[model samples]
Target chain A: MIRFDRASKRYPNGREALSGATFEIREGEMVFLTGRSGAGKSTVLKLIALLERPTRGLVMVNGCNTAALASRRIPAFRRQLGVVFQDHRLLTERSIFDNVALPLHAAHAPLKDIDKRVRAALDQVGLLDRAQALPLELSVGEQQRVGIARAVVVKPKLLIADEPTGNLDPALSMEVMGLFRRFNEVGVTVVIATHDIDLVKASGLREIIVADGKVQDPATEKLVVPSMEAER
Target chain B: MSGWLLRHVQSALFAAGRLARAPVSTAFTVLVIAIALTLPTALALGIHSVRSSTGEFANAVDVSVYFKRDVPIEKARQLAASLRQRSGIARVEFIAADEALKQFREQSGFGAALDVLEGNPLPHALDVRPKTDAADPAHMESLRRYIAAWPEVELVQIDSDWVKRLNAILDLLRRLVLGASALLGVGVLAVVGNTIRLEIYSRRAEIEVTKLVGGSNAFVRRPFLYTGLLYGVAGALLAALLAWTALQLLDAPVARLAQSYGSSFRLLAPGWRELGILLGVGALLGVLGAWLAAARHLARIEPRS
Candidate 1:
């Protein structure tokens, strides 16, 4: 679960990235964050990840106020969450297997268990055959899948993806979304930030539409689900 | 794999293997460190050699007590005889004024120059050697005062200046070695820092990804720190080799020099204690350099996500 209670973020140069914003993400929910550029979409995820603290109000992740935790403990806290970047930030120097095994290694997982789990996770994203292949040698879609395998390899309770399909074709995007749907079906909470309205419309998941640093709609007072079906 | 020590050592060795993948650069860096470490080690050996040699010279000490010309040779002989019997006295020789004059005339090449002198101008003297314990500068001064104040003694010439000068040189050498080692240690640190920095720069993206995956700063710095330790250990070994080789190169000539002075002294490498200190200090410096580099750079790099 994640909470941004009346949170706001302001850059030092006086740019208001997020202002007086709020939302709650419950357990095992698959939510889509649909917003335009500079609409605080990435900033929202960053707040939950403890990569950046909010300027005003509290940001809580899994019940702990992240702003108050010691900087050193942040890494352990982060290890509990799986994050997939839009750039498919796979370590290009290593094979797909090693890249996926990295999170387990950070946790100091046992060697045999790590090998088994990494193989199993790679199998989930359909990258098992490419396990020995380096990221540079993989196609873009395959590399993104490697990123997904790496993120979920640790069996994180929360998964955050920022534009997972930003560079994929329509077919690849749909496939990736289906893969995320499968993870969510297995009780892994997912929040994806994207500008892809068409993909959001097709996915039929709960959507939170943010614009100009604020969520729009009457549901904003309670929960702005961003679901047009609710309005109907 | 978790509790196995071989795993850690294997990882460390694997990390070192990565360094060896670029053999030329690794060799060059190790060579530079070795040379840096060797200079101070060689200086230490040299200082040790000088100290021991001059220590041997410290044994060549004596007291020259001059008697009044009117003192009878019999009186001077009695003084010498009893001085030799003193607890710490090694030997005491009596030289009557005539005997001194005869020896001077025999050795002075100007044999007739002393014949022009009247009444055996030189005074009868006693050359006294004390026990080694009483040969120190302070104790020698005390003995000189004690002997010169004797009724039969007119003057005492205990030439401690050469010994004092040698001691001063030894002290200066010690200070010089310390100063040089300190300076070179800084150089070693700088070398390690720069090496770690370059490694960090090359692996910057890897570090970013690691941090993003929730790797601690300690995790990211582990390999680089190992690399520095490796450098230090390798450099220390190389320095030991260089020091031994230098001693070997100087051994024959040094032995000849010793023989010229009626000695059997030989050039020797550092003893075990000094070797241990060298190895330990080198590794410590390596660790320190890596720590400094890691503290400065790892804090600045953040996860891009």
Candidate 2:
């Protein structure tokens, strides 16, 4: 569950990454944030993840105001949701299992529970056999899956990803998209930001188009329509 | 509680593993800390040994009251007896002129020369030892004046100036030791802090990732704190070992030197209390340094993407 009320972000270098961008996503929905490069999709995700606060207006994720949340409380707030980056963000020196078990460790989960959950998350991503392999030793897709496994290891209710399929082949990209679809099928709300219009069209998910640091009006925007409108 | 302890143990082991992976750098860092600690610890122990060896000399201050050569041995004995009744005088022993000459002849190896001389030239004297509490310079001076005013006394000499000078030198050395310990303690802190800073810098990527994945500042800092603590603890242990070895190497030579002085003084090894302090200080400084470095740098490394 995420809601943005005219959220604006201006970086320290005076770059306005987002301006009055407002949107809402209901629970249990998988949505794609479609935007060109530097079109503010990542900014939206950053705001949602509390990596950067909004310069103006309001952004809420899982009932906590991202702009007003205390910095000390940010870690606990982040544990309620998962974030996957385009670069995988895995510790290269550690094994795939260690990388995936990070979130559980961060949460101070029991060692036994951490081992079991890590294995389970890796199994879901089809990388159970590569548990002990380092991130650099794995294929790029497998590395990204390991990142996904890490993100989901804590069983966060909302999962947000930024350009996760950016470096993958179209086939691999679709496969990664299918993994997201599987998680969504089990009632995990997912938000993915991407510029892959083809992938967005093929996935047939609800699309939020952002341009020029603003969210486009869905009614008149020239993009893929929401196919699950009747359910909404 | 067990889970909490397990996490701490895990962090400690992880920190140790990281240091082990970079053995050369870690060893160099620890050596610097040990050297810094060793100087102060050795100096402190040396001061302790010096103080203990000179304990008797520090407490005793004696004066000699020599009577005029014309004074009779009977008058000298009466004067010594009266001096013993004084408030500040601890003991008084009358030495007859003949006895003094005999002692001088035996100790100075002047027997053949003295055999050719006429009658004994030494005067009767009283060896006066003052009470420990009245051995201060002013008190000794006043006591000497009191004895010099005696009609039959020719000289009243307080043989305590050298003792006072020795105590002054010891006091100066004690201050120097205190100053050096404080400065070297700061040096230890700086060494550990800088090492931890570099460690944090090298692991910046891991820190960012951990923080990104819901890791608290405390969680991210746990390993670095443990790393600092290990460095401090290991350094202290090595310093103790080094100090022990140095004492062993110097013990025989020191004993021989003391023997030359007709003293049985031996160098004292560091005791359990000193060892405990070294370890405790090392661990405390290590934790403090790591905490400082982490507090300064960790919060600035937010995940950008």
Candidate 3:
């Protein structure tokens, strides 16, 4: 569903965040993006989201080279995928229902359909009862669920979640991962970038490790495994 | 969304709702604008009324017919009556040679000295006033020439000089009104522009969010434009009302002043054309201010870093 071919992003003041990184993500498959801090994990997701343009090489999502998509068309490209961030990025001023309904609004969905889908998505995340509550009134985990509900409300074909479990306790992290797994089971392709090795291992999903502005095949990395507290 | 667009028109009717939201502030701003716009408009209207009334007073006096010295009082009186019956003549008064002399004695401070004279020195005359249209220069000249050729008439002196000068004064007053409105119009634009600039600064966060959500520049500008248009309509309406009231307030005083000067003049407000100019200037000031602010600032913010 997505491909990054020798993509490199260089900031103006000589910050090379990504360099000659080559990778491919197939359709309807869930992949774990494992990397240390500053391994260019967020850059990869942003590239797919078309929030930032790559300095060189082609990045394709859903059969179109996003590097060539006009700025105005970026919203349409983003609508094709659901995005869950570590920060949730939910608008605190609005109710949970409104936050989740944003993606549909961006797509200019019919009111009836937007309402129906928003309820259904919130129900799937078990936040239907709190739909009218503002994000600031909700717990951090619930806020993350609101973000998840927003991402999936449009039923996008691809889901790119950056550090989805970064700010959560292990229990809540597992629960959120379970939600992503459920979405994946319904033929939605999922890519999660995380620093939590234990959580990634617990999911038993294929891991693609990134380090020092480069992506590597996990099978080829022979470095000692970084130990993690499984229970923590 | 089309559905949101329809339903949210109720939501976007923010001009009224926003005013309702902040009544005191809204009223304060509106009053400031109205006062700013009203003073000059009222002055223009007063000057216009004075010019029109003074012009009419000059035009109303009409022609003076100096009869032949040998003509009798009865002949002059008959001539006055006939002129009063003329198609365009409004009023005519006959002055007998003796009556003229007697009035001259009273006004010239020679009442006692005039009795010392053996014969009346003043000639018999007829004062004729024409209708408004007949007071035109060409028409007055025609009437003067026609009356001057009469055998019983010794001289015919038509006074249209005051009419010419009144017209010149009126033209100047009109130019001054236009100049004042123009200067104040620039002031209005600056006021709206500054207000919009403050609005843009205050709503910067909301704007960034809108852009991040894929809103176009036009979408970002819609609310501010609406706000400016609101200020314009509101300010113009208040200015018009204030001008009308000022005219009403001055009508009695102005009429009394004219009466003291032996005139029947009254204060007059602007006609339809001036009203159009007033509203047009308001709307124009609003749009220009909004456009200038939008062009200056909104274009600088990128959607995302």
Candidate 4:
């Protein structure tokens, strides 16, 4: 679950990535953050991930205020959620199994449990046979699947992905989207940020459109600015 | 607890594997640390050997009490007996004027000149040796004053100045060794710290990925710490070996030099205690250097995307 009440983010370089962006997504919902490049979708996901706190206003994910969360608690907070990046972010020197086992290792899980779960996650991504292969040795889609397996290996309640299919063919992109859909079907809340409007339309998921540092209502095609006076 | 230990073992093995993969660089780093550590270790051992060998000479300080020419040999013997009775005096030997003259005649080659001059011109004397514990400068000075106050005593010479100078030199050398050890210890830390920093820089991608997947700073730093620890331990062990080998090579020469001086002093090998200290220090420096590098660099590498 996520709630952003007029959250604003201004980076150190003075670029206002997000300005007064307000949105809400309930538990067990799969939502697409549709926006152009540099349109602040990634900034929203960053706030949710606690990678950067909001410059102003409040951003809450899973009942924890991203702005108020202590820096020491950020790791534990992140462990409860999954994040997938467009680049896959796999350690190239490690095998696919080791890459997927990163999250479990971070958690200090039992070695037996880690082995079992890593295998299961790799199997889910249809890459069980490539467990011993390095990331560079795999195809781009297989690498992305390894990233996905790493994300879900810990069984996080919430999953957020940024441009998950940015480098994939349309067919590979559809397959990746289907993998996310399968996870959502099992009640995992998913938030994906992408400029793939076609995929959003085809997936028939709820879409929150962001442009020019503001979130716009897809229904009305107008900016959905929060009423500040009502909150006061 | 077992799981925690397993993680540590895993990190240690992983760190060792990384080092093994880069044999040339690791060996070079270890050599630098070993050389730095070896200087202080060898110096310390040298000081220990020197101190132990010179211990008897330092304690052999003797006071010579010469009696007046008119003093009778019986009276001088009685005085020597009384001096020996004192608690601080270990032994006292009374030499009659006749015996002193005979020894001087035989060794100084002045028997014909002395016989032409007078009969038994040398005075009676007592050689007084003090207990080792009471042989300090202050104690010896007091004993000299006490002996000089006697009515029949003409002179009381301590013969301890050379001993004082030798002790002072040894003390200075010990302090120098301590200072050198400290400075070189810092050098070791710097070498290890820089090495770890480079390793961290090269593994920047791995670090970012680990942190991106919810790894804590401690988790990300574990491997680097292990690497530093290995470097330190390996360097220390090699330093000990180097110091031992150096001692072995110098042993024959040193013994020959001592023999030339009519002494049989041999160089003492580094004892177990010294080896333990070297190893412990090496391990501590390694861990500390790694910790410093990780603390400075790991926190700055946040996942950007």
Candidate 5:
């Protein structure tokens, strides 16, 4: 589960990236953060990942206030969640298998477990046959799939992706969404940030739109300024 | 626990593989380290051999106390007996005027010329050998001054001047060796640090990706640390080989030179313990350089949200 209560983040340059943005999502739910570029959606995900902290208010994940989490514990906190980037972030020098096995390797998993789990995740992304191929040799779509496989390879309880399909065609994007849907069906919570309204509409998942450093309700698509009543 | 061990092993092997893949660059780096390390090692060995050779000469340090020609042989014998009991004098031999004449005739090969003299002109003398610890110039001088102040003594000659000069030269050589080793040590650290810096730069993207995937700073640094360690170890082995070869080349020439000098002194080779220390220092410097480079560069790289 994820919760952000009146959370705000300001950059060192005096630019407010997120201002009193608030939301909550229960376990095993798939949610989309639809926003324009630089709308602070990524910032929100970053706070949950403990890659960044809010300058004001509180952000909580799995009942732990991230603001209070010591810096030394950030790695363990991050291990419980998976993050995917728009660029796929695959190591071009390594094989797809090695790329997918990275998260497990970071966790110091056993070799046998790493191999089995990496294969299973690759299989889920339907790229099991290309495990030996290099990331540079794969198509853009296949590379993105490899990234997805890497993210879920750790079996993180929460999966947060920042514009994972920003570079894919609509068909490929839909396929990626379906893969995430499958992971969600298997009880993995998924939160994706994207500007793709068409994809969000087709997926029919819970959407929280963000614009101008504020979270807006999906039904009305209007800014829900943090109110004292909503602070509860 | 096994998994952790496996990861460390894997990281080390992976680091070695990465370096091995670039053989030419690795070889060049190792050569630089070896050369830097060998210079000081060779100098130190040179100083050690010289010190030991001079040490052998120091063992025979003696001060000759010649009695006045008017002094009686019985008085010289009494002085010798008294000097024998002194703490710093290892041995005292009394040489009467007649015995001194005999020795001069035999050693100078002037027996016919000496037999024509009316009376033995040689003075009664005492040859006093100093203890090993009192064989240096200052100790010998002090002993000479003490003997010259005696009533019957005509002259006191300390025969440790050459030893003192050799010791002074050896002291300078030792200091030079120490300074050169320290400078070369810093050079080794810089070589390793620069190599690691370049490695971090080339793999900047890999580092960023690793961090984003929940890899801790230590995890990200593991490979680079191993890379430095391998470089250091490889460099140390090569330096040992180089030093051995150098000693081998010098061994025959030095033996021949010592033969010409009528002394049998051989060049000293580094023992196993010294080699082990060289390897340990190399490895330690490698790790330190890698840690410094990684800690500085890794902090600058963060996964952009």
Candidate 6:
């Protein structure tokens, strides 16, 4: 479960990234946050990940207040949630297997467990055979899948992705969203931040619309309506 | 517990693999460190040789106590006998006035001139050889001062001025070696720190990804620390080898020179103790350098959330 209770974040340079935004999502729920560039969607996810602290209100992840988490405990706190980036931030020098095994390595999991989970995660992303290949050798979509596999390799309770399909074509984006759907089906809470209104509606999931550093009412936001494509 | 151990071993192995991937650069770095360390080691060996030579001449550093002209040979003999019982004095040989004059005539080639004198001109004296440990110039000087204070003794001459001068030279060389070693130590640290900084810079993206995925700062730093450690150890071993080879090349000539001087002293190669100390210093510097670089740079690289 994730909750942001009127949380606000202000950059040091007098830019308000988030302004008293409040939201709550139930356990095992998949949610999409829609906002234009610099609308503070990423800031919300960052607060949840304990990467940044809220300037005013409390931010909670899995029933724990992230503001109270010490810097020394951030790594352990981060291990509980998987995060995907828009850039597909895979270590180019390492093989796909090594990249995916990174989380387990960070946790100091047993080597055998790392091998088994890495293979399983790679298989989930349909890239098990490409585990030995470097990220640079893969297509952009494939590299993004590897990133996804890496994020989920630790079986984190919640997964947050920031414009994960921003670099993909429409079909590839759909495929990436489908992968998230599958993860959500298996009781993994998923939250995605994207500006793609059509893609958010097509999934027929709960939508939280952010605009101008504040969350818009879900009923009044036209982009939150289910799409005709979803009805089909 | 076993998993943690395995992770550390894996990180160390990974560092070695990275070094192995770039053999030429790594070799060059190691060579630089070895050369830096070799100068100090060779200088220390030279100082050690000088110290050993000084030790060999310790027994010859005796004090000559001369009695006043009015002091009788019987009184001087009694003084010598009493000096022989002292702790630091190893032996006391009394020379009667007539015997002293005879020796002076034989050595000084003034036989007819000395025979011209009505009475023996040379005073009775005691040649005092100090115990081996007390034969250093400083201790010898102290013994000379103690003897000069005697009521019957007119003067005490210590035959250790040249030895004192040699010791001063050795001391200066030791200080120079220490200074050189400290400077080279800083050089080694800088070399390692720069290398690690570059490595960290090149791998900045990888480090960011590692941190994003829950890797602790210690985990991210482990490999670089190991890299620094390996660099230090390899350099130390190479320096030891190089110093040993140089000593071998010089040993024959040094032995011959000593032989020509009718001395049996030989060059001393560094033993295990010296090697251990060198290796320890190298490793410590390596770790310190890496830690400094990592601490300075790693914090600035938080993942962009």
Which candidate has the highest DockQ of all? 2
- What would the per-residue lDDT of candidate 5 be over residues A8-79, giving only the tens digit for each residue? 999999999999988888899999987778888889888988888999998989888999998667767778
DockQ of each: 0.59, 0.81, 0.30, 0.69, 0.57, 0.70
Chain B TM-score, all predictions listed: 0.81, 0.88, 0.75, 0.86, 0.80, 0.76
TM-score of 5: 0.85
- What tens-digit string does per-residue lDDT give for candidate 1 at A145-181? 9999989998999999999999999999999999999
Of 4 and 5, which scores higher on DockQ? 4
What's the DockQ of model 6? 0.70
Let me know the TM-score candidate 4 reaches against the reference structure: 0.90
Note the Cα lDDT for every prediction shown. 0.84, 0.89, 0.79, 0.90, 0.87, 0.88
Clashing pairs in 5: none
Judging by TM-score, tell me the better candidate of 1 and 6: 1
* lDDT (10s digit) by residue, model 3, range B71-178: 888877877787777787777878889888877877688889888888876789988888887887778888888788888999888776777787787788788878
Clashes of each: 0, 0, 0, 0, 0, 0
Task: Give the poorly placed runs of model 3, Cα more than 4 Å off.
Answer: A34-36, A75-81, A102-107, A206-208, A217-232, B1-8, B14-28, B44-61, B64-123, B126-160, B244-251, B263-288
Clashing pairs in 4: none
Task: Please report, as a residue range, the 10-residue window in candidate 4 chain B with the lowest summed lDDT.
Answer: B111-120
Clashing residue pairs for model 3: none
Worst 10 residues of 6 chain B by lDDT: B53-62
lDDT of 2 by residue, B174-218 (tens): 999999989998998889999988888888899889988999999
- Quick one: how many clashes does candidate 6 have? 0
List runs of model 5 lying over 4 Å from the truth.
Answer: A219-232, B57-60, B66-127, B130-153, B160-165
The candidate that wins on lDDT is 4
* lDDT tens readout by residue for model 6, A119-210: 99999999999999999999999999999999999998999999999999999999999999999999999999987878977888988877
Which residue ranges in model 1 land beyond 4 Å of their true spot? A217-232, B1-11, B56-61, B65-78, B93-127, B132-142, B149-155, B261-265
Candidates 1 and 4 compared by DockQ, better number? 4
Provide candidate 2's TM-score on chain A: 0.93
